[model samples]
Target chain A: MLNQLARDVKASMSIYDAGDDKVYGLLAEFAHPGELLHAAEAVREAGFRHFDTHSPFPIHGMDKAMGLGNSIVGWITLGGGITGLSLATLMQWWMGAVDYPINISGKPFFAVEPSIPIMFELTVLLASLATAAGMFALNGLPRPYNPLFYSKNFARVTDDAFFLHIAASDTKFDRDATAQMLEKLGASNVETIHDHGVEDQD
Target chain B: MSTASTDKTLAHLADFHDEAPLVKGNLTFHDITEIVSSHTEKKTPFAWYGAFSLALAGLMLLVGMIAYLFWNGTGVWGLNNPVGWGYAIVNFVFWVGIGHAGTLISAILFLFRQQWRTAINRSAEAMTIFAVICALVFPTIHVGRVWAIYWTLPLPNQMNMWPQFKSPLLWDVFAVSTYFTVSLVFWYIGLVPDLASMRDRAKGKLRKLVLGVASMGWTGANRHWRNYEKAYLLLAALATPLVLSVHSVVSFDFAVSIVPGWHTTIFPPYFVAGAIFSGFAMVVTLLVIARKIYGVENIITVDHLEKMNIIILLTGTMVGFAYITEFFIAWYSGVQYEQYAFVNRMFGPYAWAYWTMMSCNLFFPQFFWFKKLRRNITFMFIISIFVNIGMWFERFVITVTSLHRDYLPSSWDYYTPTAVDVLTFVGTFGLFFTLFLLFLRFMPMVAVAEVKGIMPEADPHFYDHEGDGHHAEHAVEPSTQQ
Candidate 1:
């Protein structure tokens, strides 16, 4: 009963129904990465706060075109690296000097010279872990479902296609207007994506 | 080759400005996806089963031998008085050395902006992970009391004992584990997008479901790719230093000792160069077979193999120079023990192994100076095998010859590896091949997204023939400016 309840809660958290009055977004299919990049720039210029571009591979200048700033993953990695350094140092000093000290060939109990390798290793390890975890967290990944998956044409996003999506929740979003705007920006196959499928919090 | 270059045509050929295509055959994005994914999507072939069965048998042998050692103790091997470190340590170093090329290609070359690395880096990184696994096994089982291996770690045990931080072995424990973890993370980060591509192409419900979760619903969003690319760059930077240091610490295992043969300041750089040398050779060995079997010749082209050969030539010479420098230093130091160690290696019971190392590592790679031979698949394969054999013997000569005739003639004894030692060594190859075979069958052996990213059409400017003024500015990646 508890397992079933947990599953129900997760399902409720994820699913979004596009009833007669609701939609997920306006999805526009662009011909190529160059067009999609320009479309993203145009969408941002039109004051749409919630818009995204999708392509098979990362298009150069897309972040700038979309008015996005530098990624914060580097800062997260730095934080993780500092934590690892502190923990590794403390672990070694306490274990060697404070907790259970043993004399080894009359060498110092907690010398930084000897501890550098482990300290370096731990720092890199933690920093790398934080980079990966921060990337996944920032992207809101492991989301097995998305309303965008409902479109059969959208399957090609991982192939050769380029796409731009403006969510219905955006204050600037009018379904027909967004479609017309995307088409004006050189997009084809402009369509409204309904939210009957599972969706996550943007 | 020089004879073919006529004076009139030489200038024209040299002035040719067009770059060689990174991908051959003019394959579309869908074609690359299909070519890589078909191995996973299609039915299992009989040959794969046959090879897998052989590998499994070898894995079983490795397990059985290890269990036998656990039951029978270290005495089962021909480890005598001074030669306590035998095949186990030799194999440990050899396999660890073989694992270096992947990170060198993926992390180091990526940082250097070598575009060709994209094609081979995925499979090479996979090799690194598997080779490290094989390398880790030797040291784990080599510890006589295997159950008490936890003592090597820094857990709060009741005994109140802590590992010696100053010891190179403890440093090794930290280094190899960290290397493995970081490599795994780096490899996975690269795999995510490719896995998402696979998830989209997946047909069966189970395969799709598994790949979907594995991919973490990666939709290749611009915002996500921004962070994703930054994370990749950071990881690559971290991995570069980590790879260099891992082998340096491994070399510290010997160099820290006062033993005449093992003690030297040159060991760190020498060992690192040798690691890359052997690692690239191993990559060449596997890729030569894999590209043919998987029909990915265009992806991992002849040019890729030739570049690897040049690296082999470069590092092979570096290793040879190190060897000669060791001899010069040994004699010049005027230490009789160090001098004797060098002399014994050349004119001792294991002189055969020493000569084999010299010929395989130094003599054969010289053939790569000829462009024709370097590009010849048959010649490269044979030389790669020679380097692999030579590198294993190099470790053997270092470990065994150094010990078989130490300072005291009274206690010195010949170190002959018993059947158990030989079989256990052979078993690691089985373990490596088995994991590698599974990876080839299940995963995208060539990095699909990365290869696509490098294609001419992938450029946003590729389709901009209208002489658009803004494209030139957009081509300057803001990330690069940062």
Candidate 2:
């Protein structure tokens, strides 16, 4: 039953492919951030989930307009920090109390006061590392390949231009209709991007 | 209030650039990218060669000093029985304190939404990493057996022994190492977007390949940005506490001891404040020369320099208060050893060092109270150098003076740095500048993506709603596009 569902989704996705090549998505460019933001709102209102806006920097309120929930990176970092604190406490206690205990100034073996600094340092260390790692993992970074790279117009997205791309994998994606809707919404350039099988070429 | 007066107040508040532009020049997005990237992409300037040569020579000297110290042992230096922690400890604390300004500017100011940091954060973060490198040299070599430095870590071995967790020295190891790791990651994560920009613009095959790998395929995808922003915020939050703790741990090294002058309740806050004061002074010294050499006068403006001087003033005052409070506390306690330590610091053999610290840190920054002097480039430059020198002396007086005249009069002797001691301290500068010059030559000195974000033209609502003249050329007419 799962295989059938997967096949059905693939069939629907192929309908937007147009058979010339495996197109990645439709790329739409806006002259200003307001237009791009509005277009993102329109795309979300139209029930497209697998779409994103590209700009030189993050636009305030753009995430809300795009219907993106708050990121989970913070929660992951918190978890990492707690784990670090517990690990540091346990390791120090085990070393001092159980492993090879020796008397130092007749103090208690598992004193909490002196261990606080190491625990604090470890917590921060692990939290920061987890934040970086989680961000990269979520972003699917270091892939070094994307269909967007083939679009000459999309390069400006890191400069002055703002863009919104609707992936063909979206359930409602129809290439011609998406292009028209983007143009109607004041996109300056609406270009259909092909996958071009660059990954295979490499 | 009258409506006319209310309107006037609002108008005044809206004039964000009534003074001068934070980033000077009518800069387009392309212009910002080109201007910053040119420093890396263009031919290596002759001026850079001269500076790098001097730095390289210093680096060689540092190498020689380290080799000699390692071969002959710590005895070659002026570390007698009483003054065991002499120049090495002083230089270590000095360099470590110098590293705080970078994290404070990049992480703390960023969290505060200080947009001006974008113009200088890149270079400042690089300085933090290099300064920490220079700082690490002292602790490593001070171990006497440099090859056995790993024993400081809590590692399991055949001997079945562990580091003393209760010791402040062990805490220092963990704190400093963690601080270094977090600062490095924060610096690199911040560099990703700019690295991607460089990768996109690179024409040479080698340059493109190198930057492409370094950027890790950052396409500025909005999904990636969502995670990136979240991670950046988290790192900044984590670093804020880490910065405070790292310096506090360094202070604990002295404060936890029973030594009369070192055992003080105010040491943590005082050390942290002095760290920030010295760090800012170093930033100002480097930035003044950098802006002049790189011709980035417009981006790193006098306004930025004035703001930095104001910070120096605030922290410097805090340090001065700490100094006075220490004396007052010693007198109030009525402890002879503590009283003597304070008096000896001012009038004893190391009186010169104490006065130098006072004049440099407390007196020199008083000039910044005058806005004209703060804004004057040459005056600010001279004052910043003085502050740097003063901060070093502050550390020297703290570490050496306290040790030179301990509880026992029989053991007490006047401490002096040998030629090797002076050479080693100067060599660390060589290491710092060599790394810093390489960073300046190859890396983007200003964060390009962040600067573009602050431009009014980048905002869609800015052109349509605002009446500001700064972005007049780029503001699109609503009718034409609509």
Quote the true-contact fraction of every model.
0.76, 0.65
Model 2 misplacement above 4 A: A1-20, A198-202, B1-21, B465-482
B1-482 per-residue lDDT for model 1 (tens digits): 12232222223323322346668875777778878888888998899999999999999999999999999999999899899899999999999999999999999999988888999999999999999999999999999999999888998788878888889999999999999999999999999989998888888999989999999888888878998999999999999999999999999999988888999999999999999999999999999999998999989999999999999999999999999999999999999999999999998888899999999999999999999999999999999999999999999999988887778889889888999999999999999999999999999998888988876656665545345724432131211010
Output the lDDT of residue B394, model 1: 92
Tell me how each candidate scores on DockQ against the true complex.
Answer: 0.43, 0.49
Residue B346 lDDT, candidate 1, scale 0-100: 90
User: What docking grade does candidate 2 earn?
Assistant: acceptable
Which residue pairs in candidate 2 collide? Answer: none
Candidate 2 per-residue lDDT, tens place, B45-105, comes to 9989999999999999999999999999998899888888999989989999999999999
Question: How much of the true contact map at the interface does candidate 2 reproduce, as a fraction?
Answer: 0.65
Which tens-of-lDDT digit does each residue in A1-202 have in candidate 2? 9965654433322222323458778988876676777789999999997788888777766788888778888998998899889999998899878886779889888889999999999999999999999888777677576777778766566556678888887778898998899999888778878888553222
In model 2, state the lDDT of residue B365.
98
Model 1 fnat value: 0.76
Which candidate achieves the best lDDT against the true structure? 1
Model 1 chain A scores worst on lDDT over the 10 consecutive residues at A8-17
